[model samples]
Target: MKSKKIKIMILVIFIVLLFLSIGFYIHKHHQDISTDNAIIDGKTVVLSPKVQGYIKKINVEDNQKISAGDVIMEIDTTDYQVKVDHAQAALLTAKAAISAAQNNAIKAGITAPANVEVSKKKIDAAQATWEKAYADKQRMQMLINSGACSQEQFDQAVATEGSAKATLEQMQAELDASNAAPVIIAASQDTVEQLKAEEKQAKSDLAEAENNLQNTKIIAPMDGRITKRSVEVGSYVEPGTQLCSLVGLDLWITANFKENQLEGMHPGNKVDISVDAFPNLKLTGIVDSFQAGTGSYFSLFPAENATGNFVKTVQRLPVKITFDPLSPEDALLLGPGMSVIPTVHLNKGDV
Candidate 1:
């Protein structure tokens, strides 16, 4: 009886352990989150010229992958080169004017002292002549009144006195002009500054022209693949015109999840992803974050909840998830608009 009891007891213990293991497995699977079949994709970047010009050369082919800082196309740079030359000439002219203005200022400063001295000497000479002429006129007027001199002689003396007075006034004006010349020359300093400003503006124009010329050569902004080649040699492309598009290799998934299913979803959750195009391949990723609001909130026109009649709706929020880099041996290639399915394992870690 003891041997039979021992065998039954061992069987019962094994059954209890098996039930516990099955329950644990069910609980673990429940903690996981999953989604429907979606697409694997990347970001699309548009490649366009900064300035408008004719397409001179196209070095990249359609669907060709290129690295960052690679030259893709070139525009006709003749017009930009002419603009640079014009700016340079204007700058040189302004510089020459500045030099001439400086010389004029120096010469004006040098002549000031000599001009003042000459004016003073002229004023002294005019004063002496006026005194002599005034005395002679008074003597002649007295003689004419006493009948000792003729009226014609008195008239000649008066005319001499008037001429001397005019000469003295003219000398005084010369002295004033000499004193004011320095201030007049000082005002010309502004002209020098104006020329300098013009030169600076010309230099800036030259730099802008050089920048536009350099922009004629279209270069790759990032590591990407070129597509939709709408440009060719001799094509007259203008600014804002679509030449082609470059799709970046670095990509992340945007999963739209229903509002009700986002209770435990958070960043740092481990995600298992599979691409619809490649059924056998699997990718690992992490939940980056969630969008601030629903995708509909940023539509062409959002709903106005303040209206008298309103209807409640379920919204889908986009969740951003990043995938790890694929191994080189797999040779798996992905591009924009590819579909993917992402299953998030929420209970894998502390997150």
Candidate 2:
């Protein structure tokens, strides 16, 4: 009977010890963070058109996997091609105009200086003639005063001197007018510059037209799978219209854990993740980073804690978890917005 009593007492003690050990473990490891509020996230691209056009062909079906630069759709390029052709014609016309302007400039450059040189030569010739005629007239005047020449001869010499003087004056005026070579050159250069400016504008227009033509063939910007196809063959699409959503292969997890659970959690901590879609499959990751504020803080309309009496509630911090790059054999089918549960390992010794 004493032995039975001792066994009962020992059993009671063992139960108490077990409870104490469990409580101690709970207190020590309370910083372990776990949350079902997680999702698989990756690069999601919304494909759109830069130029508006009717869809000529849809090269891909829904959820079709494609690589970078793969043709996704072909927009009707007839209008764009016409624009490009018109631009090319305009560019050619501008170039022709430039050539004409250049020729005019060259001709003006030569003509202006040649006119000035010819005017200078004419002034020199006129000066020489005037000087000789005036000398003859003066000699004739002396001859007439001494009665050594006839009146008709003196009158002719005087008329010749006067005509030579008038010719010299006309030549000086011509020289002055033709010496404005700088002004003529400047006017010619201005024409050339105007033509060059027009050429530049034409080139720009041509480039824009070519760019639009290239945009008619829609190509995948990156390797991804297409979803939410909002377009079809023969359907007109406008610029900035949503055509599809592209899901990238590389993905990571976003986990929201309570504030109290952030005590021992840090970047580089290993995480055990389970996808809600595939309960049988398991994944592993490492903590990448934590958001600066709670999820509610970034919501569209955050709670106004300062406006009224506030009830304290546990706040959750968003944490980033990057999965190990999946090998070909272990690549699990996953995508963005998929639900996941993540448990962060709190041991300091692990990588």
Residue 192's lDDT within candidate 1 is 79
Best TM-score among the predictions, by candidate number: 1
Model 1: weakest 10-residue lDDT segment is 328-337
Q: For residues 2-72, write the lDDT of model 2, one tens digit per residue.
A: 99999999999999999999988776764456888899888989999999989998989887788999989
Top-lDDT candidate index: 2
So what's the TM-score on candidate 2?
Answer: 0.77
Cα TM-score per model: 0.79, 0.77
lDDT of 1 by residue, 1-351 (tens): 999999999999999999999888767644666666345557787777889888989999988989889999999999999998988898899899999987877777778767989999999999999999999999998999899999899999999999999999999999999998779578667677888898898889889988998899888889888999998899998877788999887888888878877766789888998888788888899999999999899889987889879888888888888887767433236776777889987653343
lDDT of each: 0.84, 0.89
Q: Model 1: how large is the Cα RMSD against the reference?
A: 4.4
The local lDDT score (0 to 100) that residue 287 gets in candidate 2 is: 96
